[model samples]
Target: MKILVFSMATIMKDVSMGGSQRHLRELLFHLADQGHQITVLTNRRQDNSEEYELCPGVQVLPILRFKETFPIPYDTHPFHLAHSYSLIRQYADTHDVFYIHDAQMDYGYLHANIPTVASIKNFVYPEAMISAFHTNRNYLIVSCDYMYSCIQYTVGRVQPQITDQLRIVKNGVDLSVYKPVEATRKSQLGLTDDDFVLLFPHRPEASKGIVQAFETVRELKEKLKGPLKGQLKGKARVRLLLPRHFDVHVSKETEQFYTQLTQEAKEFQVEESLVFYPWVPGHDMPQLYAIADVTLCIGQFIESFGYVQIESIACGTPVVVSNVGAQRSIVPSGYSVIKVDYGDTESTVEAIAELASTPMDITGVRQFLDQNYNYKENLLGYEELITSAGKGSSSVFSNTSLKSGSPMDVSYKLAPWCYVSGPKKGIYHDYFYTYLNQHELYSFLSTCTEESFSQMELVEAGVSSEAIEKAIEDGILVLYTP
Candidate 1:
């Protein structure tokens, strides 16, 4: 199969820098290995010239170059839609299946009349985009069930017709590159053999929970101050490795945020415990993972599926993740990974303190990864689905259903607040009502307004707006459909 993968965020030369780029590169490589010809169409804004690279059977075509004049979120670049459309049109002659990364590029793919597999990387905007693209006959692949459910719930309330296209394909990690490294690499980074390093190798953004990790470390240190011995002492010296400047721009706001976080860590008197490193080179990431006892992925928002946790597990290190989205699915049971509820500082502290002493079974961790998170196996599953879809099969993937027992449910715990419906939008009101009660969850719920609801198809099976409104009037966290 000749696949044209369209991504607005990927710059071919900087594959290792961003999650979307890394995912594109890895998937391209795997597809190429399976004897499929792959071409990538992406924005060429990083440099003035349009560049092309031929890697084995895979080719990268950079087109529609544009420069940014002001600060904007990376995904919402104005030039994205125009650039993506022009490039896809330019290469439309040879492409087979169009695999798009983000929702913003749906317009381009729809214009091209391409049979696309649009993968939802985040819960936000996916519902709206899927609803808008409902008639396009595109397969909506979600990275995790958590994201799939979030999309279903959000879209079901507004545009229920697009639910049939929803499918779950959990992101996989390349173990060949992210596995355990030599002992010498640890010494090179000034990491002692005895140090219990807890890595937070994401951007220094507040939503990524870098600040929360620092605070958790501070609290843990304070709790261990008075005569806590042995295992607790190990936890007290917990090292936090935070990567500096992962964002495209180091804006004034970002600078202030970083400064404030650093100052707060200093105030907590655990400044020395945090180690700041420039973004780890793609090749050296395995070494970084090898040195860490636990990798922390504590995002407060609904992360589609965090690749860092899988990368950590691939390197034989456990992950301590905040209970959100697909992260829970990625770290399976009986593994070295631990899960803490979102925003619960005390639980995070307790998890870190406990893991500091527990001996990690490296072999067991590797075995679990091989069984669940292995890139080869996971990519093969993707290949089968893509191939089936290309062959005009009604069921492209066997487990396209976003039900809880699907393989995509690996990191996702059955949260009572979320539910998945078919490709057509249908509300699961029971879960929505429960989710709205929690103050934090309620904030996310409130974001769903009548305008948003207009995007989904409301089913008669769902709780009526009148009933929900009455519940809300009675001070209950009820979902208002309108």
Candidate 2:
């Protein structure tokens, strides 16, 4: 079968965008191995490469950029949607099935009148969720039950109508790369045998709980300085390893948050306990996971599917995860997975102290992961869905007419706010929330209402191109036809 995949983001190696991208890469590799021809039409990376071969035979084309205007976030953005429609018209005839990576991208596929299967890897916006339910396709693969529940909650009572389309295909990890391995980076990373290392392998986002890790470490230090000092002789140092950056797309707000976190750590007198680890590419993540005594996935960030927990467990590392979202559903009764409440600092510290002395027996967890979270089983689930979506499809390019000069095509405007009664200094939409200087940001967006500014015009207005680019990526400033 010939497959055409449409996504806003797809990377071959450096997976800084997290598990969703990895999930797509693995699925395409599996399909390619099974003799299906796959071509990916995705956004260009920072380096601006035109084409790539993800594998030996699978082709990846970076052609999803907004050509007529500056790029914006992908959810129903007119430029992106129109661009997607234009591309689908070109390739719809040759591909057997259209595999869309995000539910928000369903608009183009729905109107194409072709066999389409979409994966809801993240929380779908209300607009996209409503639009997707109006589709004629039968297959809508959600990553886990949590995402399914989110979509249902977003759609309210009418969810029953779309229930037939929502299929739960739990995320999986490749055992070949994530299995138990020797701790090869302990000494190289300046760790001694007496040190207890906790790998907080998450982005520097506040929701990912870097502050919670710091608080837990500070409390652990107090415990060690007192009565617990004599009990654990060899465990003198407790370090929480946090990566500095997840990707090159670090926003200014993230930088500010990270800076504030470090300052707070110093104020709490726990700066020595925090070790900011360098960025590790996705391919070297197993080695990074192997060096840690415990993996921390505790935070307010509700995961659609907690890939970190399963991936850490797959490497024979015990995980302390928040009791929320798919993390709780995926590994309910495993000793390797210790669940704590979102902000329970005392409990998290206690859990870390207990794990410092005791080594977990991950045999049962390994067996469980092999049966459920193995990549092969995951491949089969998606393979079945893709094949089913392709069955009895005979027409393509059936609906090529689009709103060519619609208001969404001419200029740029502020995307709709997800919350109107919320804070005035922040932009909250989809999965991102970044506080901004109201005077600087609001004035710029207000000016955009009059007319779109070119790159030079923006510079002349004293707005940095970086700020506009960031706003575009954040969906705060979007392409508008008028």
Which tens-of-lDDT digit does each residue in 320-383 have in candidate 2?
8866556657787545777776667888877766665666677777778787777787889999
How many pairs of residues collide in model 2?
A: 5
Stretches of candidate 1 above 4 Å error? 47-50, 65-84, 108-112, 125-135, 157-163, 232-236, 246-257, 281-283, 391-467, 470-482
What is the TM-score of candidate 2? 0.74
* Candidate 2: C-alpha lDDT: 0.67
Full-model lDDT for every candidate? 0.60, 0.67
For each candidate, what TM-score against the reference? 0.75, 0.74
